[model samples]
Target chain A: MMRRIQSKALLASFSLAAVAGSVIAAAIIYAPEIKPVERPLPTSFDPGEVAKGAQLASIGDCIVCHTADGGRPFAGARALPTPFGTLYSDNITPDEKTGIGNWSFAAFRRAMVNGVARDGSHLYPALPYEHFTHVDDADLRAIYAFLMTRQPVEQVQPKNDLLPGLGFRPLLAGWKLLFLHEGPSTRDPARSAEWNRGKYLVEGLGHCGGCHTPRNILGGEERSSDLSGGIAEGWIAPALDKSNPSADRWDEASLFDYLTTGIAGGHSAAGGPMGPVAEGLSTVNDADVQAIAVYIASRMKPESALQKAASTVATLPRDVASQDPASSKSTIAHPATDTLFAGACGGCHMPGAPMQVTGRPPLSAVSDLRMTNPRNAIQAVLQGVAPPSGRGPAMPGFADILTDQQIADLLGYARAHFTDASPWPDLTAEVSAIRKEDAR
Target chain B: MTVSLIVNGQRRTVSATPDTPLLYVLRDDLELNAAKYGCGLGQCGACTVHLDGKAVFSCLTPIGATQERQVTTLEGLGTQAQPGILQQAFIDEQAAQCGYCIAGMIMRAQSLLDRNPAPSDAEIRRHMQPNLCRCGTHHRIIRAIKRASAVLGSQNGKGDAS
Candidate 1:
């Protein structure tokens, strides 16, 4: 009986040990190890530092994504659409219950640098931590301080709707390992401070590459072809690199002007995605603009020198045609036509006068005459330009004012005088076609 | 609650619940339509206005806090006949498209120029960074500011009136 009792006791001990071992294994498998991180806080808090951080945060446009469309600022609820699924921005506000209120500085740093959350879960690149990694620790701390002061809301963002197979989470560990870098790398001290500053802003807060640089199928920026330009949300963020045709068209002054104002004469205007960037840069300091310009200028090749030289030469009629056109009969006939034009149209169409008539484009910069296609210009003249609402009244009908032949002559004169290009296809049929189309 | 304030050098009164934003008071009550309601939350600067000559996001400014304080909207800045330097510069540079956020941008730039007559590009970018324009006209906006700076600098140093 004693032997049987001892055997039973041994079996019972073995069973308990087995159960404990299984429990330990389950815990290891379910909850992986999260390494502890400690960061050194600054010796003394500086208000200026926090202010600078606020400015940088603004430059990065952190609030746009963190804040919901109609919700409280930084009560993060912005939904980002991705290939895998939709991911909502988490509440970064300092609400202990529902937000990152209790997170340590080290935890915040890790999130910005490594794309790892406080819980050690990998965050998707949609948050743009890849670019944030380039941010300095001091700036990061300042941003943290600014965020802490913001009123925290109790709103909890909805869970991301990721694809089923992609929800394993461990896969992100591998992705992060490949793409994400830790901090701003050591700079080559040889470069000018201006160039370095530009580099930092472009790669870090400006995140110019985020939109300007094309991405792969996985949404990772193609490192091989940086700043080559890319299509984002229907607008093309043109190539900012040296090879762009328009880059040479605009001088440094024009570039600086464009970045600050969103318009540059004789080239193009900022629109779509570039508009926000201009708005953001408009807030930035002039030194930074100079630095950015310096850096961009350094990248450009001298191949555009010829193009620049060519632009300086005058191509207007005076330079192109040496003789007084009045010496020729055809030219003399043009003055007679001009007399008629002056009598009929000089009162309002003269330069420096407001276009009183609605729907009539400013005759000064009307692209229709300059563009390769003259159809729009002819149509406007035949139909008489209708003014858009909120602008002013429409131009009266020119259909009753002049014959079709006179209208054509006026168009020819306008094109020849105003633009370098020749007359486009005859508009007699096009005008009729357009009127018919409008009727239909 | 009734809040009495000075707007564009004129005294005005507005009625709103204390919690209502200054943006609503300006747009809804005063009918000063330049300040737009973009993101509603201060993420977009489309609702920026000058409060006591400082640029602030009007959407977040509480109506109760604006009592007896000076407020200025874009209309207060200048008219087409006699535009402020910044407004004129904007026109010369053709710095608007849909023009939804221009008032805010102009106000922000006006504040920047008021403080510093000749702000470096970096300073301009830093100060104007908060305003978000989806139209991507940053290049021209920067140019207009620089142009305004030059124009203002050349003038006899009379700061932005509004």
Candidate 2:
């Protein structure tokens, strides 16, 4: 009886040890590792610091993503759409109750560099802290100072409308463990200061890769295809790196001019999401813009002789309007489309026309249909160049004037006539979608 | 709150919330009717005005933000007897279709020309893209800008005839 009781007690103790051991292991794996948030706070900063911060923020393009459709700037309520769900941006204003007014400098740093929030919760990658992780201490401080000085808007961020199983914030911990790369970007010793600066800006604060580079199923930037181009904000941000199709049109001079002034010597004009980016870049110093241009140019392979000759031909003024409709009708495979283009586009796009005197760039020079996505071209046609910039001919939109079918036909005809590139396969569907939205 | 601003070379004080859009203050309080409310959001160019010589969307800009800055609306640009060069050019080009977005377009164009008196067609298109005009008068608008540039250029003793 004594032996039996001793064996039973031994078994009980063994089970207790196993349970405790499991608990300890789970704590190590599941619990957030708390670090001392020791960074100092600033009560006030000088004008120079504030100015530097503002410049960094501009490079980040913070305002475009943070501001909602009608909400105040930086009072984040912007519903950023993702494949998983719509994530509402958090307000970064200095409001004590609802914003980051109470967050310590260390907390802000951790959030910026580590993708962790003030409460030790993992932040969604939607904030682009993955790229921000590369920001150095001084520049980050400057940005923080600039943000803190802004008017404290008393706005609470709305709840994220994320799809089920996606909003489980705890899951972000595992995601971070798998993919979050933390640390400042080290410069290559072989590169020049200008090249390094460009790389730092383009890769870090500029976060150019966030939109310009393609994303994987997990929504992270596909590193292997960096700057090869990606679709962003519903428009195809054309490739800036080696895969660039129209490399001949974008020399260093033109890129610098485009970045500084939002126009590339009549070769193209900034439109869609790039419009806002150009506006922001317009305010930056000339050297920085030039650096960006130099870096982007370096990424591309030199244009071949054939490409140069083809581009020259493409840019030449073509009289698509003057051709006799009766004679040219047989040459056009899509007669209806040809007719639509002639009636709607020929008046101003043709040479010597009244509107052409306004310095209308030839339609042949326009690379509107070259993008993998048809959104820009479709929107341009639907909206017309309603906002006429000085860069190119602002064609009036035919949304109110033409049917979706007619517009599709017109676009198809223009694409067929204009470039050597393949036409958008779903042209009709794209036009219909634009029409359904009423070109808002 | 009371905000003081230098509008079109005039000093004015107005009562409004701190975050109230500058466009409302200019239109409602200052009685400057030239800048129209197109989108009320920054997306439309209808409420463009020169904020310290830079063309910015007034509808998106808060009144408090413009306290020490110069705000130039269309009313300040010129009058019937002595219209501003850009405004006169717009008239000559007949750039106004419905005329709703013309004020904003001209203000934006004025800012552009102030910076670059003789901008290329591409430069103009890129700079003036932020302002939207619903009417298909973009060609005429561009023409008016060029004409304004020429007039200003000749006045400055440098003109691009090409």
Best TM-score among the predictions, by candidate number: 2
Regions more than 4 Å wrong, model 1: A1-45, A183-190, A265-267, A300-440, B1-162
Clashing residue pairs in candidate 2 (N, C-alpha, C atoms within 3 angstroms): A384-A397, A386-B133, A389-B124, A389-B125, A390-B124, A390-B125, A391-B121, A391-B122, A391-B124, A391-B125
lDDT per residue, candidate 2, A44-73, as tens digits? 677798899998898887887787765788
**What shift in Å separates residue A22 of candidate 1 from its native position after superposition?**
20
- In terms of lDDT, the poorest run of 10 residues in model 2 chain A is A385-394
lDDT of each: 0.67, 0.74
Model 2 lDDT per residue over B1-162, tens place:
677879989888888775567788888888898899875535568988888777777765656455567888888889989999999999999999999999999999998888888988878888887788888899999999999989887888776522
The digit string of per-residue lDDT tens for model 1 on A233-339 reads 43446667766534444445556766765544333345444555666667767887766666555554353563563565222223212223345333354554443
RMSD of 2: 17.2
